[model samples]
Target: MRAGHCAPGWNVTSMKDIEHPIPVRIAYVGGGSLNWAPTLMADLAHDTRLDAEVRLYDLDPAAAERNARMGGRYAEVSNGTPARYRAVPSPREALEGADVVVVSILPGRFDDMAQDIGIPARYGIPQAVGDTVGPGGFVRAMRAIPMLAEIARAIGEHAPNAWVCNLTNPMSVLTGALHAAFPGIRAWGECHEVTKIRRQVAGIANADAGSDRWSFRDVEVNVLGINHFTFVDAISLGGRDMLPAYRAFAAANASGVNETVPGEDAEHDRYFGSKCLVKFDLYDRFGIPGAAGDRHLAEFLPVGDYLADPGRWGFGLTPVEYRTRDQARRRARAEALAAGEIAPVAKRSDEALIDQIVALAGGGTFVSNVNLPNRGQLAGIPEGAIVETNALFSGLGITPLVAGHLPEGLHDIIADHAARQSALLQAVMAGEGGALFPLFHEDPLVRHMPETEARRMFGEMIAATSAWLPENLKGAA
Candidate 1:
C-alpha cells in the first residue's frame, strides 16, 4: 500500500513515505506561549516528514513575533526542514483556511492563577497543582470558559474543517467548554499524563524508556476516565498479556527504578520517594491502575488530610516563584537563540500531538489517549461527556476504543465527577449563580466541609477573581 493508504482500521506506513508529504496548514491560538511554543517548533522541525504552514496568533503580539523569528532561525540553522512560520494579529487571520488549530493559552497570568490557589487556601483547601481539579479548577473555569467559547465561535466561522487540538490545563473542563459552545466541532484534548504512565509501565517490562525498545505501536492499553484522573484497566505487550506482571509491579513497586520525569529531578534522591506511590496505592485498593501523576491524584482526595501533610502524596504547594523562574528560563533561551550564541536543538518529544496530526491528515493510523465526547468507549460515564480514552486516529477519523468497564468503586467516582463537570459547564455557560454552589460543594476536597463553609469559600474565590469573572458569577456570594 502507498504511504497515504490504510486498511480500514489498520495503518502501516513508514517515515520514508513522509519524505515528500502533503502540506498541513496549522494555526496556533496561543502562539506566544513561551513554555510550549518552542518545544512544538522543535518537534515540527525534527519531524522533517510532513510540511506545514504555521500561523502564530497571540494576545501579546510581540511574543508571537519573537516566536516567529525564533522558528525562522531554527529552520535556517537546522539540518532538516520545518514548517513555514508567520505571526498573524487576529485569530480570524490565523484560523482562515487552516487545517488544524492548536490552543495552549493561560487565560490569565500567574497573578490570576495565584488567586485560583491562594484564595482557596484561606478556606483550608490545599491544592498541590491547582490547575486541573478542585476549587482551583472551578474558579479557573469561570475565567477561561468564556474566552475559549469565543475562540470556538471564530473557528466555526473561519475554519470549520480544522481539527481543534487543546493543550490547556483544567484539561477536561476547558475542552468540555469548547464542545459545549460549538457542538459538532472536531476537537480533542491532548495530555501528557497518560504518556508518562505508559513510559513507567514500559519500564516495568524492562523496556528502554526513551527508545523504541518496545514500540508503542505494539502495545494496547485501555485508558479510560477523565483527564489527570484516568485509569488503565489492561495492557498487552507484543500480543502477550502483561496485566498481571504490571499489576504485581504496581502493588510491589518492583521496578524500583526512578521514572525520571521532567520537573522531578529535585526529589531524585528518595528510593520510592521520587516515584509515584499514590498511583500504585489506587491500583492496590481499587483494582484499576491510576494513570496520572500523584500531584494530580492528590487533588481528588479529602482536603484536610492532604493539607495536613502534602509530602506524603509526593507534592507541595507549587509556589509562584516556580512559574517566575520557568518564565525567566524560557526568556533566556529565546534571547540566546536570537543572539546566535546558542544553536537550536531538534529532538523528538514524547508529545503525541504531531503524530496524531500526521496520522489523521496523512492517512496513517496512530493509537493514543485523547479527550473527546464519550460515545460508549467507557461504561457508566454519560455518553456525550468529554472523556479520556484510547483512540485510533486515521483516515476513518478518530475512533474511541471501547474500554468495557471500570471497577465499580472507581466507576462511581468517575461517573459522579464527570457528571458534575458537565453540569458545571452548563451552569457557567448559562450564568446560573444558584447552580454553582452545589458543584463546588460536591467537589472532593470541599465536600467534607459544611455547605455553609463551601459557600463561603466559593464566594470568597469569586470575589477575589471578580475582575475576570462573569457578572452572574462575580459576586454571586
Candidate 2:
C-alpha cells in the first residue's frame, strides 16, 4: 500500500490500518431552505479528506429540491466531484448514520412572527420589545424549544454518535434544552455575534486587511452572559490593552461616527447613526464591547427609550419591522426566481461555523468554542449547562475547553440564566409548566418590569404562546 493511502482489508502491517475506513456521512437538518446552503454544500464537496455525502432535510419539498440542485451544480462547478444529495422529510431517514448534523430551522416561520409582533404592537406593546427581552423572545423560545427537542430526540435515535450544531435564535436557551433532555448527545449553539464583534474590533483598531499581523487572535474577547447579551470585557492588540483606543475612537466620532470604511462607496456601514452612540455608552459603562448590533441592543433597554413620544427613536425600528423588511426581500427573491430574472440561486460566501468543525473533525486537529457538556469541558457550569467557549476537534473526538472559574458576579448571572433556560428546556421535554414563571422572572429584561406588570406580561405572553406550547404548558393561567 502507498503511504497516506489505506486499502480495504489491509494486511496487519501498521497501527493505522486497523482504524475505521468508513466514509463519514454528514446530514444537514433544515438545510434546504437557508440561503447559505449552496456555499456550504460547495465547501463540503471540495473537502478531500472525508468521502462526504450531503443529505438535506426540510419540510418543504420544493425548497429541498432547489437546495439539492444547487449543491449538484456547485459540485460540478467547484470540485468536479458529484456528491450525493438527499431530500427527505423524515428526520430518521435524513439523519441515519450521520457523523454531523447541522440544524437551522425557522419554526413559527418569519411571517407568523411578524404577525405575533405586529398584533401585539397594535395593543400598545412595542413589537421589537417582544423578540429580545420581553414577550417576543419568550414566545419565540416557547415555539422553538419543542421543535428543537423533537430534533434532539430524532437525532438521538437515528444518529446516536453524530455531533449536532444548532444555529437558531435564543441560542443558549435552545442549546440548554438539548443538553438537559438528550444527555448522551453532543451539541452546541452558534451565532454570528461573536465573529461580527471580532470584525468590528479589527476595524476599530485600523489593522491592515491582508497582513497576518491582525486577526481574531490579536483580540482577547471576554464574552459573558447569554448569546446576544454578551459583552466584550477586554480587547487587546499586539499584547497591549486597546480598550482606551476603542474608547477614544468612539469619543472622536461621537458627533457623526462614520463607521463606513474608506474607499468603499457601495459598502453600507454595518453600525451607524444613533445605535453607534448606544454602543459607545455600553462600552463606557460596562468596559465591554457590545456583541449584538445597535438595533438589537436597543430592544434590550427600556421600551420607553424609543416609545417615549412615539417615533422619537429616529430610524430605529422594532423587530417586527426588521422581520417585515426581511420578508419583503425574501418575497422579491422568490418573485425574481418565478420570473427567471435571477439565477436559480446564488452561492453565499459565508458558511456556517459548524461545517468547519465537521471538516476539522474529519482531520485530526481539535478546535473548541461554546458547546454543551461532553465531560468536564466547563468547570463551574453544571454538568450539562450549555457554555460558550473554545473547543478542540480531531479524530480523537470533540472536546470543549474547561473555562475556569468566572467572576462571582458573572457566574451568578450565568447560573441564574442557565437555571431558567434549563427549566424551560425541562418543561418542554417533559411537557410541564411548573418552570415557566421562574424562567420568566430570571430574564434580565423582565427584572426591570414592575412586579404587577411583570406578572401581567408573563400571563399575557404565556397566553399568546399557549397555542404552540407543549400541551402541559397550554391553558395554564
* Candidate 1: C-alpha lDDT: 0.76
- lDDT tens per residue, model 1, 254-281: 3333445554446332311235666776
Task: Return the lDDT, model 1, position 182.
Answer: 87
**How big is the positional error of residue 419 in model 2, measured in Å on the Cα after superposition?**
2.8
Which stretches of candidate 1 lie above 4 Å from their native place?
1-16, 77-79, 207-212, 215-219, 254-257, 262-274, 304-307
> Per-residue alpha-carbon lDDT of model 2 for 313-377, expressed as tens digits?
33244465554565466556644543456554323233334334543455334232344542454
Best-fitting candidate, scored by lDDT = 1
Q: What RMSD does model 2 have? A: 7.6
What total of clashing residue pairs does each candidate reach? Answer: 0, 16
User: Model 1: how far is 72 from its true place, Å?
Assistant: 1.2
